[model samples]
Target: AAAQAAAWLAGGGLPDPEAGLKWGYMEGATDYLFEEREPSPGVAYVRLVPVLRAEPTGHDLIDELLREPRSWRWDGHGESMDWWPAVLPSHREVVAVNYLPHLLYQWNHAGVYPPYLEALCQADGPVGDATAIALAYFLSTDAERGVPLLLRMAARGDLPAAAVGRQLTHLIRRAGHQTRPVVAALAVAAREGAYEQVWEILRAMLPGLLPGEGERPNVTHTEAVTLAADVATWAKAGGEVPATVSAYAMSKRTSRFARECRRLRTQLT
Candidate 1:
């Protein structure tokens, strides 16, 4: 089904803005098909939005479509078949009405968008998973917010532990923070057992306190050591321990500190 859609788009069968298309496999079909059409404009727009599947071709199709020199205009009905129209009186409105929802729906249905949009968003620097999370956070509300954000954060292995930890701590300190809710949201990623996030949080927070001071009123080294140990254990078990752990350990000059760090690294591995 996806191949057919790609061939169609590649062959220049422009998308009917009114009749959205889902460009991947469907229930009983091998290739992609025009799955649904809604009577109402908004509904139809949401229904027909194309979600690319697989690689190379999926990516190629999107690039081709985006590059087509067309000023897209959405009719009042929220659908337009024309690739390039003379007047797009409501460019912003058309984008919001016809494009934004589809982009968001792609995010919701495909787990993530193609690298093109993701790269566009992070073009300035290493935005990492935060870019994806921020989009999801804005598109979704309340209960749906943290789950997607955390998932993206977890996937982007390049994120520094310190940065992730700080974000997690800040979120936990927010007025509405609830342990169960926060932990539950994070648990999915945690189950992947990548302790980089846990370590990242600890590494970020530990340096902020005075030598003997704890992060929060009741938190203590015992707690810190325990959490660190737990993270180390999980990371080692999952074979996802960051090389930084050993590097940080080896860079230390103090014999005792170096020994402890090495021990921690060993434990994590």
Candidate 2:
């Protein structure tokens, strides 16, 4: 109905120009001040349209929820214990939004992050939401256990697998301490084919693996490099994976990083 009204307005006029308005010409020009004192009898006219009432959409609801207090305790127990009830309803309600991670974290005052994660993973929500949820979990908690789950979500096509890879790189840069576990989890996912964009993930990680001039390679950098190699080897694309990585490495703007990427690409080849 709204579309029809918009279409009607677009095609001509809302009430139609020919019949609705009574125009008069004066001095060979369109009289701007013409007004109808009264309608002539026997002429049919359109009734006035009522004002439209604004209704909230799912996005609107999510916005309204942003102002909600972060801390929560649904049951008698405090944030230390499992607080399933505090976030279950919200998970069900906000899963429709593509950015579920932000919504979930906003409402995670009671330390129910895990429960929110479990609910989102099990609820059959949008794939983007699930992917966001996984990335959010990894960034906030550095929990590698979520990697495979993220891979599964990516496999479902809610979002590109490259997004997960990019987030993994971000996670490593932010919290290098958790690098080992994240890499291990990613290796397992790749071998199992839980996600298909292993090549993209490796490519994004290449620059990070390179050390600046005269700088020594760190533990996290070496671990990440090994992980990327493992993913490239196990990936179904065979030699094409190395070729793609080599192309990206050669195209890099930073000479040092580019040289490093090409070297790594050679090892894979």
Candidate 3:
């Protein structure tokens, strides 16, 4: 309904050519100047869109997002770039991040790739941070493609650490026990000035990084732990290690990871 209204306004419903107002113009807008929240419970106030600039960005999704800035609620709506149509061509199935493992399998069988990856993997690719993050959901299992792409992005500093921090945390959480490669890759990125990003990911993922109860750590799992400890030390981050990790650190297991965990215990203590 609102789209139709916008279309009608774009059509012949505009008042006059002399009138300076243009539809969807978001200029001279400040939170104090406009309503940040609904004026009343269960009621929305009329939006005041001030027109200060009329030039288009030549990108549709960017335009729409900037169109109704007040109406965009990332907290309420899905934060993926998949919520709207993209202007660029790509083999990606939009909104497929949750089903990425399955979608990637099908794409592999069909011998195709998400075209956006080509640019995203390059230095300062044409894509934005949201696109890179959305695609990162499958990074751990997507060893052939997504992992390499992530490594390159981190190495080149293609996106700001702050912009990708939350997604990086989620990436490690999704990886679980298979976090060795990603953690190792992140250690390199940390030395390149993303140590803060590594620390944030560990804070969010350490408790869950361990194997399930009563299950011994596999080779890959132990490697992940060792790399995580290295990152914690590099970041000089000292906090209470999760109870499970602390318990294992106290045990007499003499493997590389157990030793590292004990060292971590000494530092964190």
Q: After superposition, how far is residue 262 of candidate 3 from its true place, in Å?
A: 1.8
State the number of backbone clashes in model 1.
Answer: 9
Candidate 3 lDDT tens digits, 1-269: 56765776476432211101111112334332222332223322222222222234444643453332222232323334332234222312121222222221232232224444544344222333344443444344444565455556556655334324444444454322246655655555566565655565555555656666887777766665676676677778787886767888989988876887787676666
Q: Could you tell me which 10 consecutive residues in candidate 1 have the lowest summed lDDT?
A: 84-93
TM-score, structure 1 vs. true? 0.31
lDDT by residue for model 2 (96-116), tens: 232221322334343334554
TM-score of each: 0.31, 0.47, 0.46
**Judged by lDDT against the true structure, how good is candidate 1?**
0.38
Candidate 1 lDDT over residue span 156-244, tens digit each: 55333454454344333321223334334334445555466755555554443213323222323334444565665666533333343
Better of 1 and 3 by TM-score: 3
TM-score of 2: 0.47
Q: Candidate 3, after superposition: displacement of residue 190 in Å?
A: 3.4
Candidate 3 TM-score, true structure as reference: 0.46
C-alpha lDDT score of every prediction, in listed order: 0.38, 0.43, 0.46
Clashes of each: 9, 0, 0
lDDT of 1 at 41: 25
lDDT of 3 at 2: 60
